[model samples]
Target: MQPVDLNPKRKKENPLVWIFEPLERDPEYSRERFFNFQAAYLDGLLYLAVASGEEPWNGLVVCTSHDRQAGLLEAFPVLAPHPVLGKWLYVSQRDPEFETVAHQMVKLARERDPRMGVVPGKRKRSPDVIEMKSSSRKKKSW
Candidate 1:
């Protein structure tokens, strides 16, 4: 979970730098590796993932649950089911509106779009207690 920046010197090495640069401009955003691919999060909720693998999955993966799938589908016609993260949607880089739609997605996340995020679970629960009770099994020992 590190904030990544598009290194101007290595811009040629990353084809998606242009798309990620604008997103990095926001203070609450960061890009990090998730599973085998990279994902971008806004205020701790993941909103997008970058996959440069095979077709269908090789693009921007919108972190969406089934609740808002319909609206997102209507907005981004090129979206499809992600092969890796089944719950999310994939927007192909080959789409003509890739850049435009990706930028819009960043903006939507910035606006705190209800349809754009999954609230992460809190990890502050009390510690579990382990009880060590003694059992009388010596008489049965063979």
Candidate 2:
């Protein structure tokens, strides 16, 4: 993704477009059964951040709906310290509003330091499957 031009005028021209690059990539990993679990986990955190009135720069977590018909969306905070940026950041799967929040985050980062750019890092993959074993039956119990 192109770096966001922090100039107010330029930012206004396309406030959310800069986030597209990061959002478009496939997630770090994927598992079919755990998709909702992953989304809900991230969403829960974002909700807390929004409710707490924490600065978005502290890091934001966003979750998009897996079900096409559900249309659900959520956001939260990530408390982990950024390796180089040294600030908390929200991480989430790609979604329609990713660009909007990303633009805002870029603006916030610039406010802290003009030289700071998007901190490149590897994405964490979600597990692809969960195995649940059925309890063995005892003949006596039956």
Candidate 3:
């Protein structure tokens, strides 16, 4: 039997529910929408991304640093480098064991595996650029 619906707004036909529901249980896990896709974070570090973009690109994305790439590949043999996400790994839904591997990755994330992710570098922005963006939002004094 299907699980009882926790959210009235979420449709029963939505396929992405399986992706978000499990991650929400982790206290440190959070998500933000990046245009058409959802970026999943763990302890503020982006670890997984779920997007239905195109063939080979649409599915679970494992965001890992260069150092952890080899180790992660060893864990999830089905994963490959995403075309747009640069160093991130993409596991397509076409894989026969997609659900199994995705669940395994989530479990590894919950366990706080060192191979799951890396601390992203801070974005560099000049003070003038920041001020310009913020000042534009302020109403001009007549």
Candidate 4:
């Protein structure tokens, strides 16, 4: 095995974050790191996410319901269904219109559009979990 350098390297900032920065305008806007992306929420609903990775993971993921996906696609023609996550939409970082579409997605989220947001994880079933889940307003960790 090759020698491994275990020293922690200072991580670079996620370049995609600029897309959803505008969402901060909302008083209720909050964000938490979800995997390699940052999950943006309004009030308590997760809306937009910025991903920085390879291929499909390196893009902006629009987390919304299937019913609303069609309307969102109509409004933003540049977006396409994420290959791995067909239910939602995605705009690759390399797309020419990536920035514009990202901003629009944020706008929709800021407007509290129904198309944005999806329950993060499993619904709370147990009482203890339910109480804790409601307190933070986040369903659960992925």
Candidate closest to the true structure, highest lDDT: 4
Give a tens-digit lDDT track for model 2, residues 1-142: 9997777754122222233333224343121112112121111121112111224332333221123112111222222332332333343323355446655543433233322222223455544422222233324454
For model 4, what is the alpha-carbon lDDT of residue 56?
93
> lDDT score, residue 42, model 2?
19
Estimate, for each residue in 1-142, the C-alpha lDDT of model 3 and write its tens digit. Answer: 9978889986334255377668798898888764456777889887776776577556888878767788888867888777777688888877788888888888777777887776666668899999999999999989
Task: Give stretches of model 2 more than 4 Å off.
Answer: 1-88, 113-142
Best by TM-score: 4
lDDT of 1 by residue, 30-127 (tens): 87766545777788898877766678656777888987888988877877667766778877888888878888877777787887877544545333
Count steric clashes of candidate 2.
Answer: 9
TM-score of each: 0.66, 0.21, 0.71, 0.76
Better of 1 and 2 by lDDT: 1
Q: List candidate 1 stretches off by more than 4 Å.
A: 1-14, 119-142
Please give, for residues 1-142, the per-residue lDDT of candidate 4 as tens digits. 9976676795667887877678777788888787678888777777878788999999899998788888889888889888988887999989999877887888788788887788787443789877877889866678
Ranking by lDDT: 4, 3, 1, 2
The C-alpha RMSD of each candidate to the native structure, in angstroms, is 10.5, 18.1, 6.1, 8.6
| Weakest 10 consecutive residues of candidate 4 by summed lDDT | 116-125
For all candidates, the clash counts are 0, 9, 0, 0
CA shift at 107, candidate 2, in angstroms?
0.5
